[model samples]
Structure formats: C-alpha cells, structure tokens
Target: MILVLEKASAWWDYAWLTFKNPSSSFVEITGYYIDRYASVGAFLRIAPNSSGTLGVQTHLLQKGQQYSVYVTIKGTQALEGPFKVQLPAAESEGT
Candidate 1:
C-alpha cells in the first residue's frame, strides 16, 4: 500500500489533512504531529484499486507554521513520512 499527503490547511482552531491511498489492499492510517502533542489516530480503509480522500481533523494549527506530520500503516511496518507542510496564512476579511 502507498500513502500520499495530498494537502493540508488550517482554519480557525482546526487543521485538515487530506490523503490519498493508491493500492490494491485496504489501508489503515495513523497520523500525528512530530511533537507528539496534538495527534489523531484512525483507521482509513480505502478500497482496493480505487482512490479515496480522507479528511482528518486536529486542533491548534498555527498559520504559516511548518508542521511535521507522521503517518503509519496499521498492522504493517509501512511508514510514509514526517511530511512537512506549511499552513498558508489565513485569508483576510474583505479580500
């Protein structure tokens, strides 16, 4: 199974993580920040030979701060990354 971090963004007090699974086997993903403080763990089952997007929510996402995200597959020794993502600065009001 292969895991890819598609996109990551922050709004208010929440962070949204988007992922893609492209493989012929069901995948279970566990993700967390490298700090090991604010973390989220869940099993994402993407059907075989199909592509699906998963949105995971977490708290305390600072704007413009680069985050190291760690992802691992359940029941397997497969580790994707400490993927680095920089949250874009929040949009200002009135464009």
Candidate 2:
C-alpha cells in the first residue's frame, strides 16, 4: 500500500525527492536528508524496481540559492544530488 501525506501540496516550501530501487531485489532505506533536516521516515522499505517519494524540508530564509538531497541504501552506496525543480509561475487572479 502507498501512503500520501496531505501536507504535500503545491505551496509547500520543501523539495520533493524521488528514489528508485535499481536492483532486482528490494532495497531498504537507511537514511536520507533534505538539506540539513533528516527524512521523516527512516528504515523505510521499497520493492524491487519500485520507487518512493519523500518531502525534503527546505527553508528559503537560510539559503539564498540551492541545497542538496541524498539517500543511503542498506548494503549499498549512498546517492547524492543537489536536486532542483522549478515550479511554474502562478497565473493572475483574473486570468
């Protein structure tokens, strides 16, 4: 079963990180970080050839530019990235 957090809305300041299990076997999530804050779910499980999404907390007041998000897989190497996504500008009230 998949669980989606209601707080994951368009107006959220946090960055959304996507993770995938490359191996044919299932992979366990050891740890992940969004900037400085740790992920809410630790020791999470992912199916083989499956993917999971998590919201990485970010604060614009602290950073003026960009930040990085990384994940550690159990019995495997850690993947790091300064993942970035740009949201489309909201339309005008009248438009």
Candidate 3:
C-alpha cells in the first residue's frame, strides 16, 4: 500500500510508511525529486528496511521548486509495485 504525505516542503519534510511483504527477505525505498522543469533528481535511499516509518527531512530540496517522490519494492516471494508522492511549491515552507 502507498500513501501520499501532506504538508511537504522542498526539504522533504514528511512522514511516510511502507509495508514489506512478509515473504520478502529485504526491502528498499528510494527517494527522488522532480523539479518543475521535469527534471529528475538523484535517487537517494531514504529507507532500507522491510517495514517502518520514514521520517524525511525536507531540507534536501530547494526552495521555489516542486518535486515528487517514488519508491519501488521487491519481495523475495511475491508482490511488487511502485509508490509515489507529489509535492507542490505552495506547500513548501518559506525557509
């Protein structure tokens, strides 16, 4: 399951949760930024666990810009999908 976190800023400040398949031995979550220019940012490993809450710091992003985060999960047994979240510039903090 995937959930889009609200009140996110350019720094990536938001809390999100990811579920790992019980049959899977490992799970990895990656984070990226999508700028208004339709540019893809570098992929960073935000979470490297099976199941847990990701407390992201939005400071990773730049001000006056928008971004979207996506994650891909692979289980050892079965079940795989992509999760994504969109961030708007209006939601960013004036820091």
Per-residue lDDT tens digits for candidate 3, residues 49-82, read: 3345544434445544434444433322322232
User: Considering summed lDDT, which 10 consecutive residues are worst modelled in model 2?
Assistant: 1-10
The collision pairs in model 1 are none
Higher lDDT: candidate 1 or 3?
1
Count of clashing residue pairs in every prediction: 0, 0, 4
lDDT of 2 by residue, 67-87 (tens): 555566667655544455432
lDDT tens digits by residue: candidate 1, 1-95: 27776777555545556666667678777554444555567666766655544454433555656777676677767556766666556663123
Residue 39 of model 3 has an lDDT of 22
Judge candidate 3 against the unseen true structure and give its global Cα lDDT, from 0 to 1: 0.38
Score residue 12 of candidate 1 by CA lDDT.
53
How many angstroms is residue 35 displaced in model 3 relative to the true structure, after the best TM-score fit?
6.4
RMSD of every prediction: 3.2, 7.2, 7.1
Off by over 4 Å in 1: 35-39, 54-58, 90-95
Best-to-worst lDDT order: 1, 2, 3
User: How accurate locally is residue 81 in candidate 2, as Cα lDDT from 0 to 100?
Assistant: 46
